[model samples]
Structures are given as structure tokens and as C-alpha cells.
Target: MHPVLFKIGSFELASYGLMTALGYAMAAFYLLPRLKKINLDRDTFWNLIFIAFMGALIGAKLLFIIVSWPQLGATTAEKIANIFRDFRYGFVFFGGMIVSVFSLIFYMKKKGLAVFKTSDFLITALPLGHALGRIGCFLAGCCYGRPTDMPWGVTFTDPHALVAPELLGVPLHPTQLYEAGGNLVLFFILHKLYNKPHKNGMILLAYISCYAFMRFIIEFFRGDYRGAFIFGLSPSQTISLLTALAAGALWIYLQKKETKNG
Candidate 1:
């Protein structure tokens, strides 16, 4: 509810940004030790992190613009202008994931690093950071849930909340917290899987499968402005379905390959 976390002389700090920074910082802290364990050079590891971060930011914003294009404006000029005007807000997590993965792969290859091995380390840290980002979503009141009469339903009355004007003060499902909890659980699962012996891409596939499923289910409760629905499924849900199928296929392929080699 406290979107503006604090204020100083003519300056205000946002909870969403703070939480996101904290999440990234924590992820970096977790990653450093893992990188050392994997024998990746510290300087190279930091460079990869920087590249992934930039890619994630750009991808998140770009996907948001594409998805929300219909609502941007009536004319092409206005739509283009709107993108720049509203640049500070709006992001899609899946877009960030896809772009970050590509960025990581490209950078690893360019640097002559082991891509899959490095990815195993990175994927394990992703959910922990994502969980904090969801907490930011909750505080900012974006990514809100549908109205619910359940006892645990939450009401957002803050004028600055990202909840739609109509839904302000109305009880909703608190879906942000739900996703945050799910991501935290996913982090633990991936961490454990990392410790145990497994196929190279298993942890990454596991993350995709678990996250896509969680996101697909959570989308059912989301009431915010999700753009473009087809066959009664939101854009995110559609992507989730595709991602889940792809992950399953990849999992099967990896397992078979491992068996053949064994």
C-alpha cells in the first residue's frame, strides 16, 4: 500500500524500485559464491550479470509496449509518443526471462564460457529475485487480483495504489503475495536440485516448468489490465501454456539423451 516508501526535500523513494534493487542485490550476493564454486572468473561473472540486467530491462519494457499497444493511443504517432511518455512503468516478467536467457547465452559464448553450466548457476538465483519483485508488485498495488469474498482478501485504499480506480478499496485475492510465496518455494526447490547431481539443463527446465504453471494458475485470479485475450485466455496464459509445453518437451529430450549416454 505504501508505494512511496519515503520522502526527503523534494525527493521521493519508491517501494517498488527499492524492493527490486534489493532483490537484484541479494541475487548477486548469492551468485558470487556460486560463481566461485563453479570456477568462473569474478570479473567475467560481473560482466555477464550486467549484460543480463540490461537485457531484462529492455525486454520487459519492449514486451509491455507490444502487449499494451491497443490501449496506447488511437493513432500510430500517439502510440509511439505514449511509449516514451509512460516509459517509467509497465513491464512483463516473461519477456525479461526470455531476453535475459538469450543475453546470457550470447555473452557466455562470446567469452568462451560454458553456457549451460553457467546457466545452472544463474537459474537457481532467478526465483529468489523474482519473489522479491512480486513483493514490490504487492506494495505498488500493480498485478492485483480479482475481487474475492474470502476471509484473506485484501483491500487497497491508497490513492497512489496501482489498482484500478473502480477496484480501489474493494477486496481482492492478494495474488502478488501468492506468486511471491510460490517463487520463494521454487527457489528452495531449485537450490536443492542444484546441490544434487542432475543433467546440465535440468534445473533450468524445472524452473521454466514450475514457473509457467504457477503463472498460468495465478493469471486466473489476476484482475489488472492484461492485454489481449484469445479463447478466454490472457496473453500471459497463452505464453504460459506454450512455455510449459516447450519445457516438457525439452525435459524429455534431455532425459533421453542422458539415458543414451549412460
Candidate 2:
């Protein structure tokens, strides 16, 4: 809908960037106090977040370039030029998630922190931030939904919007909001889980399982050009399947271990 949130004399503020920043701010606000309560070093926690953020930025852009390479241009020079032009608005969430996890793990180890407990503390904020990011996607008209006749279908009329040019003005499913809503719900559920005394890695496992399932279902309604498909499933969906399975197995193992110790 409203892609440009505001404009100054020559400079324009994008709704997507604003919303994403708000999400980060909100997550930080929620996290800082919790870090103190949990006895985690505030400096270490903030450092980990910064590292994850940088890693996510790089990974998301790298994956986007890799997946969209062929479509960038027909010639080498054209492709190189297109890279600079297209750098503004493309990212894959899974790529960011993958890289951020590895980065956080390495950082935690380097700092001599308890990895699982630190991850559990940090991950509770993820869905909350992710929900806002999805709303940003909605406003920016990226990650749009498939065509639909439903009354809730949204039409993107802004010429500056990122929705595919051909799909402009067409009624679409509003998949961004769908995921946003799902993530909000997930945030609350994870918050409750975090408050309760649970296994060390339960929160992380829960997030993975819940988000994987949500992403898998939501992929069906996604209309945007999301990378390649393998065996009739989109890249995200394939990753979701594997992530869900792995998380479920780990969750079970953790539960058994806790029970044995108890």
C-alpha cells in the first residue's frame, strides 16, 4: 500500500525499512531487561545480536543474488551492473536465519557463554521481530500472495510498490499479513513457554517447529518469485520440512534427557 512512508527534499523513507527498524528496536527493548534477569552479560548479548544482524544482512543478500542470478541479466557485464541496481530490496529469511544461527553460535563460544541458554533467551524475541518484518513486507508489496477471489484479497496500486509489475492492481491473497499474524501468535506462545521453567533448549526447538510449520503452509499462498523449487516444493518449504523434522527429533531427545535427570 504505502511504500514510501515519508519523503524529505530528495530523500525518501521506505515503510519496509522503518518497520524493520522498529521491529529491531522493539526486540531490543524486550530483550535487554530479560538479559539482566537471566544473568547474561548485557555486553555479550548485545554483541551477539550485532553479529547476528550483520551476518543476516550478508547471508540474505548473498542468497538472493545466488538464487536470482540467471534472471539478473543475459551477459556478464549486464549481470554485474544489475547487482548494484537490484541490491535495494531482496532477501531470503531462511538464509538470514541459517547464517545468524551459525554466527551466534560462534560468537557465544568465543565469549565462553552457555550456548543453549543464551540462544533460548535470544530466540524468544525473534518471532516478535519477524512479525513486524512481515508487516514491512506487506507495506513494501514484496512477498505478495497468489491471486485470490476472497474478500480479504489485497490489491497493490502503488506504482512504486515492489509487487511484480504484471501482478499490479490484481487481487492477491495477502500472504505477508498471514505470516505476520502467525508470527505474532507464535511470539505470544513462545513468551509463555519462556516464562515457564522448561528444558534448556525447549524454546529454540519450539520456535523452529512452529515457524517451520507456519512457513510451510504459508508458502502455498505466496505469489512472489522465491527462488527454485525442488520436488514440487519451494526452497523455503523444503527447508521447513527438514527443520521441522530435526526440531521434533531434538525436542523429543531433550524431553527424554530432562525426564531421566529429574
Candidate 3:
């Protein structure tokens, strides 16, 4: 359970951060081949992807910070200081998704990439990249699940685990694995759909709808406090519902647009 994967002199490399970087590197490798297959301009795609990558990283951190803020807060200085103390932890996946997608859509507009079409292109990358990110989460032991007695459950004795020693020796759902499995399934579906003659944004619409639904289910097992319960569901659940609705609406609208064109 080495949370610190290794050290280079004074610099300690965290398994969490290193794995996340590897995930994106894998994403670039996978995405380039797909883009070339579709005849997208590699140079422009690379440059834009880099911007999207930066946006995703910053957005992920910002989202994590926001979710973890209540614990660190009262004043701006308090919040800023908290970041210095625990920056390597506390990132919320949904928050990063929101910011990263917004940045991508905005960048697409700037580059004259059709919003829907570009979104379709991104669908494949999103899930693949995200699955890798969740792998990093598992290594870091941050977004872990509650204690359980299931046969296949995992035990994180590492001090890195958000779970305490009292909670150790007990089995717990590997919520990170749950998310990674879901995202990988989503990657397969989106990649399969990418080649079909669906409408421009159908794949994205499908991915959003599917991933939102999946995340809502997975969040139940997470031990971290995610804000309040609106009608018994946590804040993340409520947001997932909204995203699901939006995805469904987008899918319907795309279907209608395709119909009209036909």
C-alpha cells in the first residue's frame, strides 16, 4: 500500500497522480487513431485536445475543491489554505465533467467544429479516459466505499484510505472499481456506436444518459459526504437526475432533427 509510488530525490511521486497521467496518455493514443480513421485534421485535433486536457485537469481539481469545501471553510483564506494541505485528495468526478465538457464545447465553437459532431467524437474518449482516472482513484484510496461483508469486497489498510483503521479488516465495496467498470462498459458502447450511421450527437447523448444513470447508482456506496439530500437523494444524485433528463432530451431532439432532415 504505497500511496507514494516512489521518490525522485525530494519529489515524492504519488500513485494517484501518476496513474491519472497515464490514463490521459492512453486516451491520447486511443483517440488519435480514431480521429485519423474519421479523417479529422490531426494537428488541430491534437492542439484542441491539449486544451481540453488542461481544462479537464483544472476542472476536476476545482470540482473536488468545491465538494470538499464545507469542511475547509468560513473564509476565502481558509479555503485557499485547505487546498495547500489536501490538494492531492478531494476531487469530485461530476464537477470535472461539467467543466471539461463546457471547455470542450466552447473550444469546438472556436474551431468551427460542429458542436454535436464534436461531442460525438468526444464520447469515446470521455469514458475511456475516465475509466483510467477511476483506476487512479482506487490507487489513492480517496473515493472509497462503506464497510461491507461481501465476499468480493476489498480492504484498504493503507493510511491513504479515507477509511480509518477501525473500519479496516472489514470488507467494503470497491466503488472505484464500480465506476471504472461502468466507464469501460460505456467506452465499449460508445465506440461501437461511433462507427454506426447515427445522428451527429447520438453517441454523446447516449453516453451522458448512460453514465449519469450509472453514476447515480454508484454514488450510493461512496462514503464521502456529497452535500445535502434533496428528497432523500444526495446532491450528486439530484444532479445526476438532471443530467439524465438533459441527455434524454438531447437524444430526442437529435432524433427529431435527423427525421426532419430525412
Candidate 4:
């Protein structure tokens, strides 16, 4: 794993940050031209994207700080300093998604955009971007996997890598790549589903359900200290369960509404 993509003098470029930017650019490329189809102006869309990005960054970092408090530092001042000391790592995807979705909804309502329609379009491109972001996580050695005896297990040797010190040079499950591959597959599935005529919120529902299911399974292989477990399930697993159930309920309600209108 290479945390620093390159360095010149005292300055260094982080692979995680660079890849994240690339991911966002790729997603925007996929979405921008289609703005006309959704009747959204470029300026409004850019503003919405910026707001979502800020919300996601703050939410994800806050969740990470909450869950990884102990590892951060012993004192409040130390913890605060630690947060700014290394801004490259620490993020929870679900936290970002949840806050970003709410931010987008608020912006859409303020802008008089069709919530479900715009959301569906946006959701379709999220997985494609997320897929690349996972690759960044892999390269940065954050969100690493549990120790494994599997033949495909990966070992981290870079001192700059963010993996746990004890886990260095040990073969781990490569959970990051697993998720990257899964998200790529999900992007295709969601893209195909988006092209077909469906309910206004169906694409978004599908993403929530499918990703929740996938993340639930992936959590089993995660090595990091996930926050307090509820009923023996990790925090993300609990969130995934709730998210999936919520998506199901929403799907059922939408179906009933459609049927009633019919």
C-alpha cells in the first residue's frame, strides 16, 4: 500500500485524497451531461454536489471520531489534535451516505426539484464513484481486513500505510478490494436498472437494499474496532439491517401508492 502517491520536498500528495477527487470527477462526468434529462441546471447541480460533499465529509469524520475515540487519544485536547494531525484517513461510508442523502433532499426541496426523480438519478452514479473510492482505501491501507490464511490475502509493508502496526507484513483478507469489486458490480446492476422504466424511487431503494446487504457481509471480514455491537452485530451491520428494512418499507409504500393511483 502506498499512502503517499508522491512527494516533492516537504509536500506530499495522498493517494486517498487524489483517488477520491478522481472518483468524484468520474461520477460528475457520468452525471453532468444527463442533467438536461432531469431538467436541472448545471449551476444548481454543482451547488447541490458541493453541499452533499461537505455534509458527507463532516458526517463521515464525526462518525469515525465517535467510533475510534479510544484509539485517537487519552485526553480531549490530544483527540482534537489527532483529528487534524492526519486528515487523510478515518471515514464511515454509511455515515457519509446518510448525511449526504439528507443534504441532497434539503437542497432539492429548496430548489424545487423533483425529489424522487433527482435522487434516483443521483443514486445510480454513486456506486460507480464509491467503487473507485474503495480502491483508494486499499491503497491508503485504511479499512483493512482481518488476518487470514486465504491464498489471496494481502500484506502491508509500507510504513506510511495506515494499517494497524501489529498487522504490518501479515496477510489480511483484502476486504477493501472485495468491496471495490462488489461496488463495481453494483454500479453495473444499478445502471442497468436505472435505464429501465420503474418507480420513481425504485433505483434508490435497490441501492440501499443491495448495498446494505453487501456491507453486512463485508463487516464480518473487517479487522478494525467497530463500535459497540448490538445483539452481537457490529455497528455497521446494525445500521445495514435498519437501512435494508427501511428500504423495504419504503418500497412497499411506493408500490401501494402506485396501485392505488392505477
Question: Which candidate comes out best when scored by TM-score?
Answer: 4
Q: lDDT for model 3, please.
A: 0.79
Which sections of candidate 2 miss by over 4 Å? 252-262
Tens-place lDDT digits, model 2, residues 1-262: 9989899997888888888878887888889888775688777777887887888788887777777778779998998788787465788888888899999998889978888888898899998888898899999999999999999999999999999999999999999999999999999999999999987898999899999999999999999877667888888898899899889898888878889998
> Per-residue lDDT of 177-227 in model 3, one digit per residue for the tens?
999999999999988898888777888888888988998999889876666
Q: Against the hidden reference, what TM-scores do the models get?
A: 0.94, 0.94, 0.91, 0.97
Q: Give model 3's TM-score versus the native structure.
A: 0.91
The true-versus-predicted C-alpha distance at residue 116 of model 3, in Å, is 1.5
Q: Compared with the true structure, what per-residue lDDT tens digits does model 1 show for residues 99-159?
A: 9888889888998887767788888998899899889989989899999999999999999
Clashes of each: 0, 0, 0, 0
Candidate 4 at 131: error in angstroms? 0.8
As a whole number from 0 to 100, the lDDT of residue 200 in candidate 1 is 87
In model 2, where is the ten-residue run with the lowest total lDDT?
Answer: 83-92
lDDT of 2: 0.88
Please, what is the whole-model Cα lDDT of each candidate in the order they appear?
0.88, 0.88, 0.79, 0.89
Residues 75-194 of candidate 4 have per-residue lDDT tens digits of 999999999998868999888888898888988999888888999988888888888889999999999999999999999999889899999999999999999999999999988998
